[model samples]
Target: MSHPIHALYANLSARADRPALSDGDTVVTHGELIALVERAAADLAARGLGPRDRIGLCAANSWRHVVAYLAILRAGAVWTPLNPRNGPSLNGEFQRRAGLSLTLHDAASVGSLGSTARPLPLEAWLDGLADGVPPPIHDDPAAPFALKFTGGSTGVPKGVVQSQASGAAALASLSAFYDFTADDVNLAVAPLTHGSSHYILPVLAAGGAHVLLPTPDRAAILSELKSRVSVTFLPPTLIALLMAEADFAPADFPRLRHVTYSAAPMSPARIEQAIARFGPVLSTLYGQTEAPMTVTGLSPAEMTDPALRASVGRLFPGTPVAVLTASGVAGHGEGEVLVGGDLARTEYLDAPELTAASRHEGWLKTGDLGRLDKDGLLTLIGRSKDLIITGGYNVYPAEVEAALTAHPAVREACAFALPDEVWGERLEAAVAVDAPFADDAALKAFVRDAIGPVRTPKRLHLMPALPRNPVGKVVRGDVRDLLYPVDPQPLEALR
Candidate 1:
């Protein structure tokens, strides 16, 4: 079989001038996209970036950003797309750790990538795009394509090294599950630096158009969804925020075919509400940066059944997903989700100890606790790191958060455990809602009924909003830090 890049090149021959990428008034055709990539490849060569030399890209969502990514690949250099939101010091630190030779950045990141990356401003380089054709190199399927960084949702973000083979496998797995057509208009809501950016490749491969939304401007997203978007990916929080918008009528998104949501724990009740509004278009994806986004996906069709709608859906073809219990025994039921697959990363960049710790036997321990039913649909429990054990009872925060969000007013909820003198830890809930939770007592009662009294939060605090990483996964640690300030408040002042 031809490689994805080669296939993309082949597809360009048939639809040479078709819209490949666009941002506002600017639209680049497939022919233009290929020419830009080749020219940019020459620019990278002139700047001395080539095979085995790693580089970084720091830019927001733009067609130019996509061209830069493809150009890096075309030049046979490794590209790592870092979140441009990072400060210069932090970006420099990551660059040093990753040992990037160069970094291409837009105006927003040009200052942030100083000294560490032999920083190259994107505009200055684009102005000098070479007229000569790009020299071709043998395509190695096993060669590293891109180095992806995980959102520091847990802690310090780590870089995941992925090869072209794994990326192709991921694309193939998703294509089998989703239908991407030339007529589809893919909306780029997520930043190009993030994993969701990978969605653009399949669309391009399908001879479809990719529309970029640099920022998640709520109005712009709503307008795009209502008019042009056939496929788009939104994190759970963005989905919630858009749904909460006053003018957001589900019927407005008549053109939307697939709206994939993931990267965070979405409330089941909220998902059901979303499905009711947008029909079965809302898909829940379950994957980590380690897997590069295709472990399992809950399709709109499977979402029709209430029981299946709440699931993250079954594993990809030939992908082995096992839930290992505390004893490290794999089972079909509940435990840590261990996945052994081609898509999952086997090593962490510069962290051998961490890499060894994460993988068991041949399976990579996903750190996510989940269960698979007899039919193999996966239901996320909670992050094993965030699991709360209080009064000798195991409490998965996702369960409590789901219960709390089940309340009509609750928009988002996160539960954690605090140290206690008698009990090992006491359960605490921090909730974000449209309005203040009127009765903490009644809310606790609701949780108690849904889960047990042991899992109910002893203290419930209201937050205007919860902290989240760029990808929309709740930064549980940040929320915990905010909820419990230093020096501490008196017991009476709490809640």
Candidate 2:
């Protein structure tokens, strides 16, 4: 059996003249990209990197970054992604944990790795084009392919070990579900190491072009949508910003086909506006680092229905999903979402105890709280750790945030708990608004009407924007810190 990379390379080889990848400053055709990958792979092998070796890639998004990624796989080494924006300390932490023997870095990030990584410039890998074909890769479905990490929002991020089978399944599922075509041009605005990279193989397999944008720029994205881009991924926060643009309109983007969102849930109200502004092209998928993005997907056709607006969509064709309740019963109703099958990762690197707890009876236990409808549509409630207990009533912050964002005035909202004398943990929220609205009382009333008083925020504050991590997830911890400050104050005194 040939490796998945071998199959992808074979596909690219046949489409020699077709455009494969490009940044604003560089471009490579299918044939040229494959040649670079082959040579780079040879170069890596010559340096003694091979199977079971963890190779770290720390760089910004670019054509070279893409080439290095494919080349690393071709060399039969495990690819470990280190986001440059994550800064030196976090990247160093991951490096120490993964025990990376070598790290490939861009010119910009070479200094950020400090002394922890055995850093080499990414350009050095591609320098020897005459390096010849890479050695044949051993076909092992269970072989570790990539090491991905969690967001570390709750605590320290764990390294999720992804097998070759899981990666192939993810690419296949995404490719089939999105229905990519040869004419498709995917605009990659998210980090290639994260969500954006999932679309790479699928698009390439279809002989489609990838337009790489190092950063998500609304103007450039709009420009691409008006012309060449057919498919792209945007987190909910970016989508909200795009919709807020004065000149943005659905009619301008006639060629745009799919605008997928994930990372964080979009408010149902915002989802409605997105559909209205971008047509039926809006889609979403729900998955974490362990399972990747193939677990469930909401197709463009499904977004048109108001009833399923809050749903992440039905499970992918071959994926297995179940909901486990608080009492540890797995069934068809509300509880913690569990996943099984080829797409799920089985372990965290070197952490047997943590890995053991993350699974139940052969299924990977997702820390997410969700409920599966009778038809298999999954509606996420929130993270199990994010559940806020106020007045002895369990209130998921996602529910409260959704309610707050549903009001027309709000653009983004974050719901969190504050220590309180009476309620144990009082629900408090902050929102970034589009247009100026009435005071906190009016917004609080709107949330109260939507989700009832028990879930409604006790105190609402308005900010220009909510703080988000590099990957665009709203940082709830930062919100609390901003509201209360460092020295700490009594809740009554702060209020």
Candidate 3:
């Protein structure tokens, strides 16, 4: 029952000379990482920061962010990692909600937050710390450790409270599933603010090396893969971009043992391309910010399973998952996915209603709509909130969108329900096509033949590009505004 921070310290003590973290030119050994965290803890303690107190961190993924995170936990304070790219209004709102007394930022991040909050730069803060030895503190596993914020598609970010026990349990489950060891090296490509970065905690706990790529550049990431990185996590969009960039073969990443993907579903074709190019090293996980690690995972072998290619794989060991419907509960067909286990978050920081609504009894009601097949593999339908009730029938947008994207001419597609006078709601699809089809009628006919009449989009609009958020998730709100234009007739009539 040791705290995660304490567990990290133990790993450092066990392998002092082993490399623990790397950022481009800088490499920190386990011993050096411990020293840096201790120094930072001592400095923060001097500022009167202690257990349960919140410290806001607005910095990019770097060695500094890692040191500060460990130090915050070491000093017995809750660390709130903010996206450096967020606007002042959002940052201010988060700071107020979290009751943050001190803020830490890099030089550039400070400028973006305006001049009012003259925050201490992380590098300077680390330099100014005393060289005092870190005092021995009892490791309490149940104490609050970090507050991870996530907006998902709803775009209303809420802080998910994580305790030391929950963190350790997640790390333990990951270690067990992935077979992590002291020699393993994990390359972090996504923002540290997300659940994907939580995988790093387990790597550190296992005394493994962590190489961070703060920038989302494909060439830079490929260069690092050629270096010491063994395992890495990537969203599907990044993997697609990498696959399209070069004539890469499986031998390109000789040392790479695994490539994990989450945050969004990957098309079967894209997944096949990745697996064929990288060998059978692709792993797809399904989970959310409230539960930071894998609720279920499609294993490397399963990726090759013709039957399971469309599945999200079986649930993780020790985690309980089920599908429930509007009539209380359902089984083996389709419903909202519910999860309950060691990895579940305690509660939202300030949003009690959200906490109650999302977490009923002990199971967290993941808004994702999916179901277990006869063989027990989970197949994601779509988010319940994203379900289109068209013509009084439940239509999952993911199913329709997948069907649309399956067309050779379509590059990407997003289907959403729009209000209609005749039907309660009708489905509209905005697609990004690679090139103009023979005609609009021909393209519409192609979709109708591929997905059948019921799932066919009522209206199809050709867009130059589909709008995406920073993390590459399609901005449905923007898509809605585009497909259902405010004044469609004025422009059409003028033409």
Candidate 4:
């Protein structure tokens, strides 16, 4: 089978003059994109970088970044993305872990990369189209294609070893699930180093245009959706931000067909509000860094049902998914979510023990606690590690968060655990609100009524905003650290 990059090259060649990537002010045609990729690929080969060699890309989302990525693949080297939003120390650690030989970076990210990486200007890759093409390399399904690290929410990030087969499967699945067409234009609102990058291959393979927004600016995103965009991917946090924009409305997005959300679950209440604001374009998929976002999908049509809206969706066709309890698979109940398919990452690089522990029964243990209904629809409860046990009762943070977000005053909520002397672990929550809601006791009562006293958060605090990771996922750990500082608040203040 041909590599996904080779297939992408064929598609690019066929389209020629059709616009491939746009940065609002600039447009790169398919023909132009190929020429850039060919030149950059040839340059890499001349520099002695070849198959299996890791090349780091640290840059913001742009037409050039996309070209550089494609060129890295075309040259048969492994693509390793270093998110610009990450701290220098974190990126440095990732650089050392991945053992990247050379890093291609834009001006904005050059300072963030570690000194260990041989940083090259991304713009300088295409010195000129080479005299002859680089020597052809054989496609190997199991060869490393990309080196993406997991989001370090739980602990230290681990390098996920993604095979070429896994990357191809992700590309194919996204295209099949979304039904991308030539007319489809994908507005990349999220960072390309993250989830937004997954949509690029599918859109490109279908001969569609990719519009790059430098940042996830709500105003810029609104402008694009109002005009050229037909499809886009955003985290639920960002969707909430857009809704908060004074002018946000369904009528503004005439061309939008798919508004895909993932990274974190949006509360059912927020999802309903989104449906009203964005029309039926609100769709979502559930997957982690290990799986690369194609496990299961809920289409816009399926989202119309309020009950199904609570679910992440049914498993994607041909993808293996199960809910595993302590004993075995829970065919129609709640347990740890497991995935086994080509789309799942092969293993963690340089961490055999970690890899083995992460796998269960020949499947990748997703670390997500969820339920599989008789209908095959999966509803994620929370992360296994995030589950809080208070007074001998298990409390899913997501449940409490969902209830809090359902309140009109609350904009977004994050529930987490605090060590308690009485209860094994006490459930406490922080919320970002749209309106003044100083009555913490009343808010606690509201959540208690929604679920029950055991499941509801014992304490609720209003925050200006919740702590989020670079990709906009609310990090519960960070939220805890922020709320309870080293100095600690007085007991009276806590009450």
Tens-digit per-residue lDDT, 331-408, candidate 4: 668899988888875789998998899998788999998988888899888888777778888788888887888787
Model 4 misplaced stretches (Cα beyond 4 Å): 10-14, 127-129, 487-495
Candidate 2 structure quality by residue, lDDT tens digits, 1-495: 525685556455567899889799688998888888888888888889888788999888889998999888889999999888788878888899999979998888876675565787877656645657798886788899899888776666789998888888788789888888779999988888787888887788788889998877888878888899899898887887787665667888878989999888777778888888888899988888899998899899998998888889999878889988867756578998999988885479999998988888888988888889878899988888787878999999888988887787787888888877788788999898877766688888888888899999988889888886655567777788888886244444423
What would the per-residue lDDT of candidate 3 be over residues 130-225, giving only the tens digit for each residue? 886555564676677787777646557678888776677667767776787887899887877666567766787678989887778888888777
C-alpha lDDT score of every prediction, in listed order: 0.78, 0.83, 0.76, 0.83
Cα displacement (Å) at residue 293, model 1: 0.8
Positional deviation of residue 485's Cα in model 2 after best superposition, in angstroms: 2.6
Give the 10-residue window scoring lowest on summed lDDT in candidate 2.
486-495
Answer with 2 or 3, whichever has the higher TM-score: 2
Please say which candidate is ahead in lDDT: 3 or 4.
4
Report model 2's TM-score to 2 decimal places.
Answer: 0.95
lDDT of 2: 0.83
Clashing pairs in 1: none
Alpha-carbon RMSD to native, per candidate: 3.3, 2.7, 3.8, 3.1
Which sections of candidate 2 miss by over 4 Å?
Answer: 1-3, 10-13, 326-331, 486-495
